[model samples]
Target: MAENEPWQDPRLPEDARLTSLEKRLKQAQLEDAARSGRNDKASHKGRSQGMRILSDLVGIPFGSALIGWLIDGWLGTRPWVMLALLFLGFGIAVRNVLWIARQRPE
Candidate 1:
C-alpha cells in the first residue's frame, strides 16, 4: 500500500468498531439521564422548600386558632383555649422557620 493511501489500522475489526460506538452511545445516554435527574431533583427540592415556607407562614397560626376555636365551641370553653393554642401555634411556626433557615445551603 502507498505510504499515505488513507492508512487503515487493521487491528480493530468492523464488529469491534461497532461495539465501541455502541458503548460510547450508551455512556452518553446514561450521562444525559443522570444530569437530567439531578436537575429534576434540585427543582423538586426547591419547590418543597418554598411550599414548606409558605405553609409555615400561613398554616400554623391559622390551623391552631381554628382548631382551638372549634374545640372551645364544641366544649363551651372561651378565650382561654383559643389564646393558648394561638400562642402554641405561633411558637411552632417560629421554630419551623428557624429550622428551615438553618437547613438552607449557605
Candidate 2:
C-alpha cells in the first residue's frame, strides 16, 4: 500500500518478473558450481565421447547385419552371407571402438 514499496506493486510487468527469475536462476547455478568443484565442460566432453562410442558399437553391427540379411534373401543363400557380414561388422566395430578409446582427449 505504501508508495516506496515496489514489492507490493501488483501491476509489475511480466517481462520484469521473468528477468528477475532469470537472474536468480543464474546466481543459483553459479553457487551450485562453486560448491560442486567439478568442471562441467570436461564432464560434457566425456559424456559426448561415451555416447559416440556407444552408438558406433551398436549401430555399425546392426546396420551391417540388416544389410547382410537383405542380401542373403536376394541371393537365396540363407544364413551364410549374413553370418559373414555380421562377423565383419563386429570386427569393424571393435576396431573403431579401440581407435576411439586410444585418442587423446581434447
Candidate 3:
C-alpha cells in the first residue's frame, strides 16, 4: 500500500496455513505418483535416456568438426579435412544410436 512497499497477493497469504496446505498437497501428489507408478525415478530415467541420445547426436559431430577445423587450420587443407571428419563423426553417431537402440532397458 505504501509508495515503495511490495504488494502481496490476497489469494496467497504467506502464513502457517499456506505452508501447511502446501506440505499436504505435495505429500498427496507424491503419494499419488507412487501409486500410479509414475514417480520421479521413471521420469528421471526417461529424461536421462533422452539426454544421452541428444548428446550423442549433437556432441560427437560437433566435436569432430572442431578437431578437424583445428587440423585444417594447421595443415592448410581448408575444408577438406573438416568435411571428411564431420562425415566420419556423423557415421559414428549413427552407429552409436543403433547400439543404444539395441540396448535393453534398465
Candidate 4:
C-alpha cells in the first residue's frame, strides 16, 4: 500500500473491529471518571444510606423533645416536668430504632 493511504489490517473481522472500538471507548470513559474521584452508583448508595440514618436519629430525638417541651410549657410546669418528658421521649426513640432494625432485611 502507499505510505499516505490509510492502513486496513485484514486479520480483524468487521464485527470484531466495532466491538473492540466500543470496549475501548467505555474503558477510556471509566478511567477518566476514576481519575477525577467521581462517586459512582455504589458510593452514592452508601452516602445516601448514611445520611438517612443520621437524619432518622436526629429527627426522632428533636421531634419528640420539641413536642414534650411544648406540652410541659403549656401545662405551666417548670424544668423538672420537661426533663421527665424528655427522658420518656428518648425511651420511645430507642424503641422505634429497635423496631426499625428488626424490620430491615439481612
Q: Give each model a TM-score.
A: 0.53, 0.63, 0.61, 0.45
Candidate 2: where are CA atoms >4 Å away? 1-38
Query: Residue by residue across 4-102, what tens digits does model 3's lDDT show?
Result: 235656565467866898999999998998798776666777677778888999999999999999999999999999999999999999999888777
Residue-wise lDDT of candidate 4 within 1-106, one digit each (tens)? 5322347666645666668889999999999988986647656665665566566677766776787778778888766666776777677766766665554231
Per-residue lDDT of model 1, residues 6-104, tens digit only: 466666445666688899999998899788665456677777887898899789999999999998998889877888999999999989988987774
Candidates 1 and 3 compared by lDDT, better number: 3
Q: In candidate 4, which residue ranges exceed 4 Å CA deviation?
A: 1-39, 88-106
Q: What C-alpha lDDT do the candidate models reach, one value each?
A: 0.80, 0.84, 0.84, 0.68
Candidate 1, overall lDDT? 0.80
Q: Candidate order by TM-score, highest to lowest? A: 2, 3, 1, 4
* Worst 10 contiguous positions by lDDT, candidate 3: 1-10
* Residue range with the least summed lDDT across 10 consecutive positions in model 1: 1-10
For model 1, what is the error of residue 18's alpha carbon versus the real structure, in angstroms, after optimal superposition? 34
